[model samples]
Target: MAADEGLTGSSRVTVFAMFGVAFGYATHHLDARRVGDVAVVGPLTPGVEWGLLWQMARNCGRATAGEAELARWVLTQATRAFVCGSGRIAQFPEQGWKLEPGGKRVRFDSTYANRDQLWTGNLTVEGLAPDQVAQRPTIYTV
Candidate 1:
């Protein structure tokens, strides 16, 4: 349905819920990319499928009130990181980068260099505020 509503291609949906209120509403952050509809709530954290479970509540006819609020928050807190080969290798076994767990640092791994093996891991996205971190899986294409 979201695709019918102009969400073509692919998007990464990040869904989160706010507590404290009696009946708080959930929010969805859509990150448009060429990958797929990869929805992430949290790692080792409780979550819900806002789009699949509460489609009617979302009221597709109009925009959700949380959209603006989430956008503002994302703009202020979110950070994007890209990892790839250095492309400086003049030989068959080129150097590849390995991202650290926190997504703050990366190092060169010879074992997986030159695309010998694939490296899969989780990227920790820290918010602007201290002590806030969200874990997102690393996705790449050859």
Candidate 2:
């Protein structure tokens, strides 16, 4: 009985050690490359997302009310970040970008406005000001 108990314990320890090694190797193999201008879309930290959303909201009513100006700015900044790989808006100046809520959709350009309702988390914007927008927050979709 004593010898049998020792064998069982040794087997359990060996299994655990093997599992640990496999987990470590899998993590190392599944590493992802860093993206420049894209907000990671997944379950994000609330504090970070809220902070970015608040800053954008504050700037929403600055030029006009009932206008999707905030949405437009968010999209533009996000696009720029994705394209340039810099994640820095200062590098790309805003060229009279405006966004209007088209029913459920937010339009991007001034002409030929493409209307598509924005599903929260599907698309998001961050960085509205020099100080506010620079703090990139993780975004998640429902």
Judged by TM-score, which candidate is best? 2
Candidate 2 vs. truth: CA RMSD? 21.6
Q: How much lDDT does candidate 2 score?
A: 0.25
Assess candidate 1 and give its TM-score to the true structure: 0.17
lDDT of 2 by residue, 50-90 (tens): 22432554464355544356555444443443345333323
Tens-digit lDDT track of model 1 for 39-93 = 2211211232222222322332246545323322222111110112121111111
For candidate 1, list the clashing residue pairs, or say none. Answer: none
Deviation in angstroms for 119 in model 1?
18
Candidate 1, superposed: residue stretches over 4 Å from native: 1-17, 21-33, 43-123, 131-142
Each model's C-alpha lDDT? Answer: 0.21, 0.25
What candidate 2 gets wrong by more than 4 Å, as runs, is: 1-43, 49-51, 88-115, 121-142
Clash counts per candidate, in order, are 0, 7
